[model samples]
Target: MTGGHSGRQAYTGVPRWLYALAVLAALVVVLPLAAMVARVNWANFIPLVTSAPALAALGLSLRTAAASTALCIVLGVPLAVVLARGRFPLLGLLRSLVLLPLVLPPVVGGIALLYTFGRQGLLGSTLEVLGLQIAFSTAAVVLAQTFVALPFLVVSLEGALRTGGQRYEAVAATLGASPGTVFRRVTLPLVLPGLASGAVLSFARSLGEFGATLTFAGSLQGVTRTLPLEIYLQRETDPDAAVALSLVLVAVAVAVVALAYRRPGGRGPDGKAGKQASGERPTTAAAPGGALT
Candidate 1:
């Protein structure tokens, strides 16, 4: 028996207010983006980008954002796995704490970082003993970006992990697969869509990071003046350049997110493929949770 249509079901009983709210939300973002796009000096866009300061800031932003995203992948994945599968008594609290950065004001986060890593701060003396400094440096920008962007990766991966559950992993273990093998062959593939989406988002967040970077890394050209900081400096003297830089950032972020997010909706080598590869009927795991006893 085939359903009449296997695609999107038309919304029939939706409230009109919901539509109104959706439009409002769309406008909230769209209006600002539209205004920025309209304000861009397209004719001078190339020169603006190639300008020494612009180039330096853009390059720094790209490198720091990439470094931050990479750091997120390294640290966030384990955190996600733990959050997804652990049965600790304080698991919920742990998750809340991990996600705290998302809600914390960026400036406050910068201040927190300053106190924790500043030359005269907590670990400062210890680092000083090692002759390594972190405060007001390129490293600080990377750290600030990583701190702010980590929650995005962790939350996305956790949700995907939860949605994926541990059924495939259990089956692999039952079939004599080692934990490492199951994780590499089963777990990683299952949550890849989320991973990609999260990475893109984190990169976007890192690219736009301003508050924390400014508070922690000070705007030193060629050292830590990332795109946003550069734009801020330019805005007062050259509004056109600022507008152009904003447009460039928005374009890149939009493109990256669109590409990564599009993968989830497509039938591809993603979560469902793992189940098919294992020749098992799908299980409704429902959440990243502790293994079945």
Candidate 2:
């Protein structure tokens, strides 16, 4: 009886410390966000947020972020599918290269963009011959945002594809479903949660992007100036408005993550499934020889 009580005490005591640490970590993360919210004046919040420049910046931010996210999905989904399931020499190196944007400083990314798209850049001469200019325009802003946000979408989708089993896909194939049908009806549904989560994350990251947008796209109001740019501009003049704008960005990011959490098939970290279907084809099962399966 004594041994049983001591064992029980040991098990319970270890978790208590862990619980305390978790609470402390939560507090550390939440306090700064709480402070930002508390600093805003509710009375002037509406007028401050509704100002023409603020509204324009917000509109551009949303439009560009949405457009960039769409582009990321179009370009990233295939790359992620390939990287996650395909086998090739230097594939590991390729995956690491894709994640460069996530680790590299945004400023460095902006500079890289300039070298690639600037007037004297490698492709710049060709673009100029076609009477096209990419620098410091609305299109430039979208391109810059897309460059920074694409990696988030790709990485997230790859993880989803890896963990969301291919059992349904295999079952679909056994039922004589066409490759396109299997992907559309089976694989897509299973990874829908990941797609949604990745899109939200990409949108949030695009909206908050500052350095790259400013450096590559420039900070022209009603053109390339996004919410972050607006906030930086306001900081030197109206501190309250700056704080308010910061709060709005924070609120939007939190709302996106909250919505992701509320999505269907949303599982907690510990509740997530392990490895998805291995031996599945990199492409859809419809291809010849059924390589993608």
Which segments of model 1 are wrong by more than 4 Å?
A: 1-17, 263-293
Tell me the TM-score of model 2.
Answer: 0.83
Per-residue lDDT of 167-239 in model 1, one digit per residue for the tens?
7788767766667767777788778777877888899999999999999999999998999999999999999
For TM-score, the strongest prediction is: 1
lDDT for model 1, please: 0.85
Backbone clash count, each prediction separately: 2, 2
Predicted candidate 2 versus true structure: per-residue lDDT over 61-92, tens digit per residue: 99999999999999988888889778999999
Query: Model 2, stretches more than 4 Å misplaced?
Result: 1-14, 171-181, 263-293
lDDT of each: 0.85, 0.81
Model 1 is weakest, by summed lDDT over 10 consecutive residues, at 284-293
